[model samples]
Target: MILSWRKKRAARRAAKKQNLEVTSNMELTIPSHFRCPISLELMKDPVTLSTGITYDRDSIEKWIEAGNSICPVTNQVLRSFEPVPNHTLRMMIQDWCVEKRSYGIERIPTPRIPISSYEVSEILSGIQTAKDQQDAERCREMVLKIKELAKDSERNKRCISANGTGGVLAAAFKTFSKVPFEQNVALLEEILSALITISPLDGEAKSYLGSDSSLHCMVWFLKNGNLSGRRNSVLALIEIVSSDQQKIDELLEIGGAIEALVKLMKEPISPSTTKASLLLMYHIVSNPPSSANSKVIARLTEMELVKILFEMLVDCEKSICEKALGVLDEVCSYDEGMEKAYGNALTVPVLVKKLLRISDLATQFSVSILWKLCKNDKSEGGDVLVEALQLGAFQKLLLLLQVGSTDGTKEKTTELMKLMNVYRDRAECTDSLDFKNLKRSY
Candidate 1:
């Protein structure tokens, strides 16, 4: 009996010790460095930022993808979006996971980036060689490969773009301009697709692209290429010229850039493509034109841009309406653009309907457009006023005053009301206005 009791006690003590060991293991604290700054959890894939801070790749990528330019840990602007993988830190985390596996920690495998720096550099070097050797087939294959790489992931897109992809491709374009446009459709499409995959092209790339050959190449794609090619060209132009007046003038000097853009807008392949064209138009026309570009405004008039834009304002959703009105407002700032807007039968009604109905931005643009049309109408004793009064614009302007608006918008509203004060009794109108609890983030 004594021997059996001793054996039972020994077994009970062993079980208690094992339980204590398990409890201690569960209480082990994760090191600060092992934890991601963003998630405050053990990192699965560690990467070092240019700011010299480490974060989990997933966390940092999510931050970057959200359009943040600053590092979360350092609170400093990230010089480069590229995050170098910290293999050592990742391994350390993996080892810790293994050590705690009995406590339910799972070891993570090695994480892969979209592409390595070496791979990107090699492809770029090959592209340069193909361009120099005038190997059209080799160049096409190389560029298509790049497009495929860009499509792999956003990280790959940034990786290839951050390298010399744009410069080399620009050089390729300079060479390929000698090729007949019809023959190089696939090649040009691939090039633009690759560039577009990494949009907001860096300054170096933009400078490289801001040349006669590049502009004319995109113009050809815009005018003559297939639907996909056309959309890609316009999107490429938006990233290329952006708001640079000099580049805009150069693109204009290329002759068919504006015409091709306008034509695409008229016969759009899709809503997204049409929206892209509108953005490009806004970028080009909104910027101050160079002294040598006197015919820019007249060209817009000749293209019937005002009617087209008003039509877009009439049919498009709130997002597109805002873009269309933004471009239309800029176009109407000039005498020629104003002449086009004036001739449009739906101009006043559409502008009035857009007010307070879309967004503060749309309403502001509509107000400016209305003010211009009204001022332009002063010669006819404000036909714009009569139309605006008929469309209940007077009540909307009053609402703008009551709800409050930007100083410029308010001033324009007051002026419009004053201009139309004499015509208020001429037309019967309803004062009903519902904001629908519309919220604006701007």
Candidate 2:
């Protein structure tokens, strides 16, 4: 009777375990909530559902707040739109890999045409021989051939099935970088003319000007030529740098580029020229060089460049204001003296007023500048900064923090919070008039 009772308990336990396993498998088999309306594929990164709903993985938790999750297909409220979970996905992939490995499945086969080092060396030697002989026509042909080889090499460097849309642009930069200085200058002129005449090459030409090669050429021009050459090079560099948002860091790194650019910004020029110079100046100021020289900062302030930047922030042209604010961001990075000069220039109020009046890129830029200035720990614009906060600046910044799509705006939001926290802490510690009530509204 004891043995029979033990057998019955073991059987009951095994049945319960099997039932649980079955239930788990059934849960996993349930279909996902919705498919993409555009591609009909499972919703992936930047997933947008029907009823105009969208959520990235990072924001999905916030999006799911208040439990309003709904089906994209029928617009019916969903209890949950939980995905398969990352660990489950990883297990699936691992299982797939194991199965493939067991079956001896080959994904990427070995290349049929392997590169021969000896053949490459022979080709390089011939090219060198042509150049050594000073055979201009032969060398030009060799250069063209070498460019082709470089393109091939670049193609091979990328994944086999990867997109090659940017490859041509990359190759152009590579080839231009290797050209002699004289040839490079001529090429720059050609590219500039091409940009003016051809719409198709406009993007490519702009990219070429911003390339490291082009920057190197600008450095060469700055060091080797007269004042006029330096001015022209700076102007050219400014034009290229202002065209694309991604090249800002590379633009800041050129040798003596910041000082040269600041000099251009200070010189008296026509409104259009000044606007262009100011635009570049703003980018330089907002982004700042990785390393800045004290002398450069002094010269910029002495030349009244900071004041000019302040003026540009309130300029009639929205584009100019936007770029100037970008520069103001960088300018505030200097020591306390520079910060005071920046605050005394009435930059904060101008930016606050602009934020109210302009709602475009200029306003966004102005808000970014204010965020930087007010947040700086050493900033001396006490009443002005507080007034900016009281005048709805903090709310504007918070809104930007909440909705901004660009990485720059996101970073500005984070910095703004840090500064506000410092202010909050200071307010708590001191008998200084409690602007707490005022700041809270913001």
Tell me the tens digit of each residue's lDDT in model 2 across 1-442.
9999999999999997887666545533212332334344333333334443443332453445446566544566755554222333333434443444423422322222322444445544654565455444554454454334434543222221122212233234335545475755544333232222222233554665666776776666555545545555556656666676556667556666666565555554455555656666665554434454444455567656667666545445665566666666566667632564454535655676675466557666665666656655353635445655545566666666666547876786667655655444333222222223322111
Evaluated at residue 434, the lDDT of candidate 2 is 23
For each predicted model, how many residue pairs clash, with residues at least 3 apart or on different chains?
Answer: 0, 3
Provide the overall lDDT of each model, using Cα atoms, as 2-decimal numbers.
Answer: 0.80, 0.51
Error in Å for residue 392 of model 1 = 1.2
TM-score of every candidate relative to the true structure: 0.74, 0.39
Which candidate has the highest TM-score of all?
A: 1
RMSD of each: 8.8, 21.4
lDDT of 1 by residue, 1-442 (tens): 9999999999999997898687766777889999999999989889999999999887999999899999886789999988898999998889988987766678998876668779988998888898788777888898888888888777788778778787778667766765465576667677777777767677766765666777788888888888888898888777776646667777877767788898888777898898899998888787765444337878887988888887666667877888899988888888888877777777877888788888999999999999988977845556778868877888899989999999999999999999889877776664433323323211
Backbone clash pairs for candidate 2 read 282-327, 285-330, 286-330
Model 1: lDDT equals 0.80
- In the predicted model 1, the residue pairs found to clash are none
